[model samples]
Target: MAVTVSPSRPHDTITGTPETGSQLTRIALIGNPNSGKTSLFNQLTGLNQKVGNFPGVTVDRKSGFAQLSSTRRAEIVDLPGTYSLYPKSLDEKVITDLLYDRGSAGYPDFVVVTVDASNLRRSLLLFSQLADLELPAILALNMTDVAERHGISIDIQALEQELGVPIVPMNARKGIGVAALKIVMAERLATHPVRFWEPNDELLPLVRQIRYYFNLHNDYLALHYAQQYRSISFLSVDDRQHIAELVAQSGFDATAWQAAETIARYQRINEVLLEAVTVTRTEKREPISNRIDKVLTHRVGGYAIFLGILFLLFQTIFAWAQYPMDLIDQGISALSELIQSSFAGPLVRLLTEGVLAGLGGVLIFIPQIALLFAFLAVLEETGYMARVTFLMDKLMRPFGLSGKSVVPLISGLACAVPAIMGARTIESWKDRMITIFVTPLMSCSARIPVYTVLVALVVPDRAVWGFLNLRGVALMGLYLLGVVAALGSAWVLKTLLKARERSYFIMEFPVYKWPRWKNVGITIWQKVSAFVWQAGKVIVAISILLWVLASYGPGQRQDAAEARVRAAAPAVATAVPDTTASQELERRVASVRLENSYAGLFGRGIEPVIRPLGFDWKIGIALLTSFAAREVFVGTISTIYSVGQDADLGTVQEKLRAEKDADGQLFFTPARAFSLLVFYVFAMQCMSTLAVTYRETKSWKWPLGQLVYMTGLAYVAALVVFQVLK
Candidate 1:
């Protein structure tokens, strides 16, 4: 067969010429999941990276720049991992789309396919398919260290000749063989000289028509187009229609053809591996992973272990992040004071009370966010996350969710935006929908600020069991409540939403390994950065707007209100000592001015609606402002409290503790605090999450329904808790 190369892309040969200009060579990194693809990508593009969306899709597209050689640099595009070109989920479909559509911006000049050296036959399935496409590609035989430990060995040169591509042995975990792989990538590319599968006479006509119509050279490529034409986004309506007509006329059986092709390809792979690979030790010694799984995966022990880990994780988040959080708070407070001292106008008040207060709230939670993601990353890198999914499958199946739902649900602890987006991995539409609907019920990092502030108000700071901190226990209790709420919500959704599609969970348990600290650090950096930058922008804007609303009124109501308070000050001075009375009078005047302000008026307008939940108008204002983001509640409270008070009044938590009703009762009583906590646990307060839900489900109906149901649940739950306790 003649290799058909695009005339415009003449550098398709094994020893292709490098680009002469500033254009970076594009390399597509493709692999199976857990094939060390992430490690290789990190090694290649240490910090030169940015994530984006695939063209016309919400699936994340992670690409980064790397200097492949002294003179050549490349943009490495990390495509979603898939076993083969046959697409399952939207993520896998991206791989098929990019490779199939040469005009796609993500299409690579060359491909680097990472494969597990120990699982050679299984991993090579995708590489073989790519080779058949005649794309210039190299095989990155990763996990060789693991293979060696397992007494599996391969002749790299022999395998390279058999596959007709360069095979670089890589222990990506140890950063081994990266240099060799870079040299190969920079200097040359290779295509499989031998085709793995040829179209039989029965399907020859269908393949030929597709090839001729699409002007394609490779038979396998033509076959893929014929099979995936309907799913292919680049194919126009006319082209898909033409292919459909051709397919109908040919009477081609796609399923049977796919089965035959897979069998044929694997048969060839078996032959090649037999010649180029060997196992030195075959004594059936159980692996260490199996031994460890015995205890970790046990029905009873596993759950205890999982809960213990969760408890430890939350405790660490509270303990480890406290110092940094306090430092950030103090620094922000100092800055606010400096602004108040430096300027003598409305701008200073806006800077201190609005902008600075909002920023402090966002920054204070960074340490906790970082620690949460770091723990998650460590779990993922060490492969325990897969075990968690496997362990949770039994519990999930009863609720009409599959093992796949566990990942997104667990990920919801970080943020629901990405967690909802992560539901794309669930192939079943019903399960995916259910997962999206319930994921926000999990308390995310955003809830940390709100929870910490509230928990401190109600829960004592002493230990519960002489070792476990009472505050930590309360925090974990809140998280458990969220999880329970999510599962309960899922059960409700299961009953309400009809299931038209079946759900299946097929997951592989990877061998346990030590966490790569670099990857962990990178994950923490990215997640925390996203939180601050994306959420911070909204917080700042809302803070400034809130300042405007709280600083002014419809007309002279605020001034008149403050004047009335001052008019009564003389009597209060006579009742108390002069200095103490003056301070109390100032405080009363500030309160009246805020109550007459626009935000206060709005808060009072809604106070009766939330009164059953034990919320007053100030808390009502916070509830409304925090709809933009849950963490914004603390900032809104801080700004509102700081509006007319001295800079030395105290932190938001202290101010909240000191707040009282006209009846001289503490405002944030335990009943009210826990009620608010429960409200936040169930409420769908995040607008961004709702927007992402709309995008993921491709319908406003689902998101709208989600908002209504969750808000209703929050209201009822909060009301019940407060009524029972009060």
Candidate 2:
């Protein structure tokens, strides 16, 4: 395909590309869920993409640079998917806000509406709405390949003429016709030639008044402001108030008007599709997806299959990730040993025991994190996750959660911060709040380090009945425990909270297809990198802080303690071999030095409180540090043990496994390890999760309530487990 740039835009003389400092044109990709919109965004942007929040909302913003031509480049923004302009949830409201407020940073110069070619009628509703708003949009007839396979055909030229905008039929997943789409984008196509909807005569006068007052060119845009002025943040208070008065004067019936407008748009869409689209059936047959869904979504079979899949997923995470994790653990140990031997100073200790220890603790789990995300990405791309959501709706509904809440709950398994933000898509205020309240109970990937380490220490690695890994089963049980806790909490919140608004779950099941490997790879890269970087920063800071407290004490207390330990040691006989006695004396000195340090003082202060749960001062220290992030627990324990021990360096797991109590039993006993695991599952350990909950709810009450409840629950649960198991 040949590309051409509009003459209006300037270019660099030598390379024929846009001028070095010139701003790139902004293009927005809008589509419904499962419309292949994200596939196209990935194709256009590739590795140049980033994810963030829109200006004032928590809805995700995905944007990247795309080279449309030698002289033209576009900054493509992937907006949250929505079916129509009418806002039903916070995610959908972002679409309306960005499109209506030209002053918003994310507002686009042009729109690319990704239309599912197989579902043209429903997809066109949004495209038609954009046309009425007079946004410059091009129809991306995506999923054309899938449509063709299902006996659907479309006339691209006829549809282009009917919508009065350029149409590009392409399989975004396969990169077909992308070049043609780029060529069209480089042309700076005009808005659709026809207006698809206009306010009826009764509302026309009011719409005209709004248009004139706001100096807006499109009547539909002005009408939206009139209907949604209260919620539109971009509008000035005075302007909104005036609009409110005008609406009052006109006695505007917003619901009736919106319904009438939707009916009219569909009427126009029907006429257009009648001329441009055709579906042929040689014989009556059900789709392969439907046949598969019969078993995949069956009332009882679906749940069994989901559980089986989850079991396999967790087992694979453990087995496949072990080798790489071992390599990482070994590498970090080697580096620490080299650092210790090559240098001698407080800085050296900090480098090895502080930064490296904390960083290494999180890094060793990258393989496991990547594996987890890879499985999730495959399920999502294959369109099986939607079925899971549909299947779980019945079970969740009884717990006061809608099917829509399933996405966030599942997402919480990866990270609670974003998952809490994901609750925006749940339309009901009551359901969304309930989701936010209980989502933190779902164990996240951050807890993987703590879980793996604890499980390895207590749970046997050998297979049960020569098939299932006992360790894997323990991990699954931890995750399932989190789910059960979340549901039970949700049920309790349902009873406590009162709501008059009824909740409904409406969802579409996308056709099953092979997972797109590129998309899966991107998802894995993003999730893993985010974990390492975000968690790395917090861990590094805490590691340095903990090292200072662990290394020294106030007013020479550490020196005094060491001196007392040496004085208390019995003299060894020079005539007889006493190596074991000497080593034991040295170990006693190391332990005394650490116990008197500031960190030890702090931990001892909390020991009495956590004693009932079978936690020693060391475990108490870990519990406090891990509140910043659950993964930090491993690093905290590593640093504490490293600073306190004068022995050979090893992996955190090794150090923890070798830990012993005064009575000579292992410190992390089966009862205590599982008790800690259960505590973390119920704890509000991530401050970021609390912060995000606050941002999403815009009130301190919800986050404060969540923190108090979850922490109390963790304490009680841990106490019970310790008492029962011990």
Candidate 3:
């Protein structure tokens, strides 16, 4: 096959000048899943990437800026991977909508369709479809090295001629052909206007009528507009109605036309593959991945291995993060002390107790958060996460959940907001809803700080088997408790909410490979940074508000209480040394001010309600404040203790350890600590989570029901634990 080289028309009329007037060229990278598309994108864009959601959807949108040449820069968007333009799932629909709707924000001027060299026929189906759309596209035959290893050879020139597009053979992972890929992208962006596919004779009149009606660019695009007019958001309601009427009048059956188009595209793909590709082997031995899967996916062994990995992950997170966490704590404390000594009065108090303290509370968990993201990224990059989902399907089905539900449930450990969003992929509504409802029962990162503090107090630091640290084991137990609670609650919900439709689980497992360290690092950076920024904004605002509320009272009550404490100071000085007496006087003054403050009044008001769970007034305050977000429990405790700005978790723990009730008994005994842990495990304490749930469900009824049920379960469970242990 011989091809002609033609100068394709530029997207806009500007020649030798930057497109979009200083705006970088917008190029979209799209391909089938596991086709090395993301690897190519990562290589091209490096660290200049940002992740967000597409308009009106929860699916992730990843884009990055790449400098293609000295004078040429491009913004590349990595759309969700899909097998075809025809939509089956929400993610696939997103890709189709973006490609079909030219007015959409993510519409690209040029497309780089990544094709897996090892699977030419299957990968090129999407390429052919894009070609049919009359869009200028570059074919990136990625994973050439893998194809070569598998004894597959491609005639690049012949394939390019057959497909009528620029073909670039490159290994994206090793960066072997990245420079050539960039050169092709820049050239194609400047000039590419060849339409490879032509409409069939039978559909010509329908296509022409639609093209004339809508002023479409070509016949293929018009055909798509006719077939998918309902889903095409760019078209108005009246336009869609008119198009529908026109299609009816022309005898265009969408399903039959789609089927005929698919078959014709496949026949063309097979011809192209046969002409340009060669396979040396007639038969192949089983791959290493299959051999490994036999053992890892075994019913009993898989569960045990999964549990062992889970334990080790938690153990590593707790054991390795301790040193860095301590350092961060000490550094924040030192900074707070410097601020306190450098300033004076209410300004000092607000900065130290309000801003710095709140920041310290959230920043202290950075080490754990980074480690968690790193592990999860590694698992995903290695393709082990897919296997985990497959392994979990059998276990999850009985609880009215799909294997897909495992994703959201596991993601809940990081945070529930996105986890609930992740549940949208589950095709079954009942399974999706149940997954969302019970996901919050899983212990999230917000609850980790609280668990660590309380576990340090009650659980011993000794080892269980010389290799397993006792505290690590205890942490694993807490995580397991959460998993058990989530599954058990899912079971109960399954009974209450009848499934309207049966759901089947289908997933493709990518071949296992060594994790790309660069991608893993990027994932970790993105997740940790997002967590800090998102949570930090809320924490800082609430901290300042809380400080004011805790600092002031209804009237002169705060003034009168401070006067009483100061009046007794001199008499106390007669008995004790002057420095000790002054220090005690300062402590007494702080305590009096806190007790007479509005926060104190509120805590006391709620004391009787939480008293059954062995919570004191101070804990009552933390509980109320934590309803906004669970992690605020630590910040609230730190504020209420009136500890120095230079206080660490150890300082707060010591303060709580020494705290006594009216009967002079320790406040945080084993029973109380366990009760508090149990309460947090089951409580619907995060307003943000509830808000997300409401948004996902599109109704207040579900979120309201969740709050009542989860909170009631927490109260009853905590009450029982405290009553039995106290």
Among these predicted structures, which one has the highest lDDT?
A: 1
In model 1, what is the error at residue 93, expressed in angstroms?
Answer: 1.5
TM-score of 3: 0.81
Give residue 489's error in model 3 in angstroms.
Answer: 4.6
Better of 1 and 2 by TM-score: 1
Candidate 3 structure lDDT = 0.79
TM-score of 1: 0.83
Candidate 1: list runs displaced more than 4 Å: 1-22, 237-241, 400-437, 443-481, 494-503, 571-579, 607-619, 628-678, 685-708, 716-726
TM-scores for every candidate against the unseen true structure:
0.83, 0.82, 0.81
Model 1, span 1-726: residue lDDT tens: 111112232223555566677777899999999999989998899877776678876566888998988899999999988889988767788888899877776678889999998899999888888888988887888988888778887877667668777667878877888987887788765454446777888877899889988888777889998898888888899999999999999887789988988999999999999988899987588888898998888999998998899778767876898899889989999998887887789888988988887788667767766776778788888989788878888889988787778767876886786677557657666788899999999999889988988899989999866899999999999999999999998998899897433566777888899999988877777666665666567656766787788788898899988887777768757476588677667766666777788878999999999999999888888877787678767766765564333333236678788888889989899999999999998998876577568766656798899899999999999999999998
On residues 445-480, what C-alpha lDDT tens digit does candidate 3 reach at each position?
889988988988888889877799988888888889
Give the Å error, residue 45, model 1. 0.7
Clashing pairs in 1: none
How well does candidate 3 score on lDDT at residue 675? 96
Q: How close to the true structure is residue 135 of candidate 2, measured as C-alpha lDDT?
A: 82
